[model samples]
Target: MGQLDGLKTVVTGAGGGIGAAIAVAYAEAGAAVTVVDINGAAAEAVAETCRGHGAAADAIQADCGDLAAIDAMLEQAASAMGGIDVIVNNAGVTRHAFILDLTEADWDRMFRVNAKGVFFCMQGAAKRMKAQGSGRIINIASVAGRGYQSSSNAAYAGTKGAVLAMTYLAAHQLGRFNINVNAICPGVTYTEIVSNLLRDRAAERGVTIEQMKQEAEKSIPIRRGNDPEDVAAMAVFLASPGARNITGQGFNVDGGLINS
Candidate 1:
């Protein structure tokens, strides 16, 4: 039997990158999944891949930054899947900019999705989970939240720091309901977003993409950047029966980038 057989899962920002990887992994492990993203076509494409894995999957296009959208999305996902067993709060936004260059819009956008979006998703999921008597909520944070030196920007880091704090607080409050809350902080994961950022940086520096990637890996203690799958593996494990007892913590999938 698959590890997550019969589990009902909702993954946000699942159109691409780490979120897509996690959604596919859950489907492969036998969970019925709802793929949520702001990009409708991209969400549907990933949902198609999940269906190809022989698992039930639905795609919903909604912006995580909007509360009304979040409510509707959760309602739709729950109705389609019968009930929500897991919620992966993976929707977030960021841009590479110097602290001085960051604008009010940048901070607002990042907080809208990264901090507020994640919290309400957890709150919404926890409400259902409390009634169900069990659930798993996984937030996708970043090493930037732990004060990583080379974080993309101060505002982005602030948002992730909010996520980490919420994860811990939610875990404590939801534990009695048998709902597990955790956060995964990834460091230098090679996703489409990272690739795009690297592409822009490469153009600015007049270097090959491969060289930029290698340079990016240099700061990692293991000298390796994560594939989206690395984060997916952790998501699967956390949602599986194996992680039922694990909660109230942030697990860094950073290849030893930060000691704490």
Candidate 2:
């Protein structure tokens, strides 16, 4: 039997990137999945992929940054899937910018979707799982939160750091209810977000995108950037029975970049 057999999972920001990978991974592991994204068509496409993988899947388009939308998204998912067994909070955004380049608007946007959205989603899912007596919550953070030197921007890092802090607190508070809360810190994953950042950075430095990518990979001790599946694998594991005793921690999926 699959590790997550018969489980019902919801993946936010699942239209693409690390979120899409985690959603597909959960589906492959025999879980019913709800794909949540701000983009309706993109959500449907990923949900279709999950269904093609032989799992029951649905799509919901809702802005994670909106409180009402967050509540409604969870309601719709629970209504359709019967219950939520696990939730992967991956709704995040960032851009390529230095510290001085960051503005109030940047902090507001990142915090809304990355920090606030994650916290409320965790709270909403925990309330449901508390009654059900068991659930897993995985927050997608970034190595930037751990003080990665090459972070795209300070505001983005702040948001992720807030997620990690919440993850720790949620785990302790929800443990009695049999709910697990943890965070995944990804580094240089080969996703569209990183691609766009790289493209822009390359232009700024007058380097080819490939050259920029190579330089990034070289900085990692493992000498390669991560695939979205790398993060997905950790999400699946965290939700599996093997992680029943684990909670209140941040797992770094970076390539030996942040060895703490």
Candidate number of the best TM-score: 2
Candidate 2: C-alpha lDDT: 0.95
Flag regions of model 1 displaced more than 4 Å: none
What is the clash tally of candidate 1? 0
Candidate 1 least-lDDT 10 residues: 192-201
lDDT of each: 0.94, 0.95
- C-alpha lDDT (0 to 100) for residue 157 of candidate 1: 92
TM-score of each: 0.98, 0.99
Candidate 2 local lDDT, 41-70, one digit each (tens): 999999999999999999999999999999
Error in Å for residue 143 of model 2: 0.3
